[model samples]
Target: MKINPKNGVDQLVFGMKQNHVENLYGTPDKQFKDEDGNVIYLYNKEKLRLTFYEDEALRLGYIITSNSEATLLDQKVIGKNIVEIKTELPFKSWEQEDFDSTENHFNESNWLILQSEFDVIIRVEIGAIINDNDEFDWKFKA
Candidate 1:
């Protein structure tokens, strides 16, 4: 499914209440707080993470996952190679960071900061993605 700001990433979006999410997906497998004070709901079995803001109401902040349905620009990203993703998404510009592949982790891992028309910064990891507000300073930090 195409990622929509109103509909949210995959199944949830910002401004959605925590209870509404619980009702839709049932209780999360586990929950934890991130260093940024966001509440992260982890469904390990599904490889999904729903993060909520630190407000008392717990509004959805972002969604991080490797779910097959969590797509951007019509690309079915889960399990897809980075090359395939690069082909499907029309990223205006990007910043890439490479990770050293070790003996224990032989796969070549990298991070791509995909800047899109949606005005969101998509952090594309080797096997997962983190979609959040574009706090990237386009003029200075890019």
Candidate 2:
């Protein structure tokens, strides 16, 4: 699903496969396949560390800071709900545009548009899970 930053609406939808990571974000710098056949890819860019994983069938992705104390910072910053995090640090219009451009090229279940102060906007999506859980689970479906 693609989101409209100007409005809180879902714009488009597409299908994706289990090995579609590169198609979505190009090749990753480091790739690790666990003993259980789960794959994890790491992409390092400036202050950001993008981690993509197919853990047991669930497609889990996250981004974190790459500062010297990144591990400590991650422990403090990771796993917060979007609403809680966004309330403290509102997204800007330019960021929304960047997000829209990046995410629209990929496949998602459903997308959402969120507005903030200064007319800023953000697009969010419920991504797929590639793990070994129940196949019919709709947890990520928006």
Candidate 3:
């Protein structure tokens, strides 16, 4: 599927309603609220985690995956380094730590973050985060 950062994963969009998500992905494998009150729709079979804000809109905030089979458009994402990844999906502006620095997953410093209208983060030796702030307070929220 084509991964459009501005729109969303395939047919999904940043401001799309929860029903739209259900229509696109079907029923979630699991659904729960995070500590901060965001609703998480976990599709274990699909290996996708979709998090929505806790407001009237309930807009999508985060799209996360650790699945190696997942791809952004035709680009294979999992386990690839920044250089190889860039060749597939080149980003102009990014935030990252020193290559030799120890990982800090909580802070997400180990990943290379490309924050535009949407936030696309590629983790070191792991997965990726395709996020959208939308009406959220910060550009990049936890």
Q: Among these predicted structures, which one has the highest TM-score?
A: 3
**What digit string (tens of lDDT, one per residue) describes model 2 on residues 1-142?**
1222222112211122224545655676777776665555555642333333454243443332322222211222222333454445334222243233231211222222222233322222233333357442322232
lDDT of 3 at 115: 20
Stretch of 10 with least lDDT, candidate 2: 5-14
In order, candidate lDDTs are 0.51, 0.33, 0.53
User: Clashing residue pairs, candidate 2?
Assistant: 1-108, 56-131, 56-132, 57-130, 57-131, 58-130, 58-131, 59-130
lDDT agreement of model 2 with the native: 0.33
TM-score of 3: 0.62
* TM-score sort, best first: 3, 1, 2
Q: How well is each residue in 44-106 modelled by candidate 3, as lDDT tens digits? A: 876667778786357775666655655554776555554545555545444444444332222
Better of 2 and 3 by TM-score: 3
Candidate 3 has which clashing residue pairs, if any? none
- RMSD to truth, every model: 9.8, 13.6, 8.0
Per-candidate TM-score against the hidden true structure: 0.61, 0.30, 0.62
Worst 10 residues of 1 by lDDT: 102-111
What is the clash count of model 3? 0
Worst 10 residues of 3 by lDDT: 109-118
